[model samples]
Target: MMSITYRLPQVRNLVTAFPGPKSAELATRRKAAIAAGVASSLPVYAADADGGVILDVDGNSLVDLGSGIAVTTVGASNPGVVAAVQEAVTHFTHTCFMIAPYEGYVAVAEKLIEHTPGDHAKKVALFNSGAEAVENAVKIARIATKRQAIVVFDHAYHGRTNLTMAMTAKVMPYKQGFGPFAGEVYRVPMSYPYRDPEGLTGAEAAARALLLVEKQVGAENVAAVVIEPILGEGGFVVPAEGFLPALSAWCTANGAVFIADEIQSGFARTGAWFACDHEGVVPDLMTVAKGLAGGMPLSGVVGRAELMDASHASGLGGTYGGNPVACAASVAAFEAVEELRLLERARHIEGLIRQELGDLVGAGVVGELRGRGAMMALEFVKPGTSEPNPDAAKAVAGACLAEGVLILTCGTFGNIVRLLPPLVIGDDLLTDALGVLKKEILAAG
Candidate 1:
């Protein structure tokens, strides 16, 4: 593979103390201006980012391991994406696809159809966020199936909207005080091998979930079964091997739309274009965002032709659904994925991460190391026990940040530290980040 250049120096250079004077000022401003509900993982404010480094307002160059929550797989400031956005702005920014359509929107839809799983006839409807894409997918499924019930798994995170909040499983932050959630959204158990009872096979886990669906919410009344192929915010839990296939088959047999929320796991973040490709399980509808438009805000629901067209004309669109600039950026992102061979890159990263961090799991600091390709995680657990160790997770993250590496912690119990480094991250930078993470994990434990 050929080496790629970055605009910023790809090194973890702490010019000043972590959260230096400039970032401290920004934090003060943020406290007065930004809402308390909004939170930032790291306090430092970014001035520029490229490849694997984020140059903060304090001029501290920190290694980027979270990829801005998995949005910049191609790189934070990929040359192609930057140029595409610039060109698009010159032509015109927004016309709102509902009023006046543009070629970029249609072009993106074509790319979705060609790349997404299955050879079935498909159509696309663009949106502005992952939440919007998920909501629309549910809408389309409900309209087409003439059913109201939507089935989701435990440890699932669809989005932050009213309906998605109902779909989400965690209660403390995502759902607490956000009452009167949308009705008919049923939650079933997920196939969590690490936490499941001993000797429980993937097929057995599927049966357990299926039994609940049939007994609690009759299969006939179900409109859709929405799940993240690899649970994203829910700890990057890779479901047992046969679990996904069983659910897909059940949805097909029971006449329910199987929707894959690949918002964080899609594009080339995983070794495949989509996580469902791993199991050869094709979803009826797939919600995509995050990595879709490089760093631009864009999302979409790509699904079977008939179901996508079920909604009446003008029934599904937002004022900024398919922004032309976002679409252009998305086109460039798609090109980068192909031209840069990110699928192979992601696989290579998977090997490196596992080889580097697998020891922590054996040492009892990390309970499990799971996920695919560039989207792996380390679940912190109490020593020699399966109990969650959120304190360890927190400590490791803070320590990494103090040392000029950026890592993110997540999970229902917030005991998992997820690794989402840019696929274009340099080998040297990634190794340095992992070394910091390793030292911190050991110290925290």
Candidate 2:
């Protein structure tokens, strides 16, 4: 096995139907108790999860290719996280960093500054979620640059909060009916190689986007240009080479803060400490969450010391911005990343996934197989054309689910199948999951 630390068997086993009786009952209960807006991709309910397997309420052992939407990079129930949390909870749970600060919070911030890119002096502020981190990042950028306008890209997904909803591009699910979003947020074109006009170089894409910012948003008014180095909810879109560097150069020249929203692609999820490392592009501010604290809810904005300190004391902080329990979990999670060598593990998973699914491209329905490390995706399109085919993506995911593998779909077109297995997954389990995925994808074609 791939050095699985969890006790659960690293196997996909379906003791009952996809959503067995227990899960079906839970789904029935969920309909009545949960909000209609909160939707679960699968009807199954988890009873326990560890390593690469999720033992559902129905007694099915599902192969976890989704990794709780890329949150459990070190695996759920990681021993380090569990032990640290257990120790921390026994001592104290909540001592909001703003009131009685603790070493765990400071330690976590130190870890973020150490891992984040750049040799420049850096500082960090923790938060409760990705949206909070992003909102605060914008606040810091604005205060530092004394500009109001915040620039984002097409197909970007920042968060669901008001400001983030304004930053987010998708309208149907996240932003629909959540209107009257925060203003001063501008949208720009992304470096989408597959969908961009043919032969458009990364620099060309950068120029095109910059022209829009200059003409429409006014570069002088732009406080921050926020983007995901690898688009997360926007289909794991890896920007074309030279795109990021060009943007960074423009931001520096114009004094607009370049914020890398590394929520879904940071903390060793993309085979590196952060996706920005792939291109050697360092941001003025970096927002991080998802895999930062294993499965705990913790997020942070780490950036240049001056910009991060632009806000006066007591200007930024929430009631539970840095819960002691969460901070302990984050410290443990960072240690797990180092102890388990998850950065290399992410790359190893990437090689396996590419070896298995790389050939699907240009094979009728699959137009692209892209993304780095464990955060990979397959874009489904109509045969012989670039037209999106979300149905094919859904069909493949459904087929895999029926056989006890869980995968997630994303993209503005909803035509991408994303794979985000825990970094601690075994080779055998991942191979089995990929086998199911490949078989179903071929079947769909």
Using lDDT, give the best candidate's number: 1
lDDT of 2 by residue, 1-445 (tens): 1355568888899999868999898888888999998988987999999999999987899999998889999988999999989999999888778888889889999999999999999999999999999999999999999999998999999999999999999998999998899999999999999999989999999999999999998989999999999999999999999999999999999999999999999999999999999999999999999999889999999999999999999989999988889999999999889988899999999999999889889978999999999999999999999999999999989999999999999999999999999999999989999999999988887
The reply for model 1, stretches above 4 Å from the true place, is none
Task: Give TM per candidate.
Answer: 0.99, 0.99
Tens-digit lDDT track for model 1 on 207-250? 99999999999999999999999999999999999999999999
**Candidate 2: residue 142 lDDT (0-100):** 93
**Residue 232's lDDT in candidate 2:** 90
Off by over 4 Å in 2: none
Give every collision pair in model 1. none
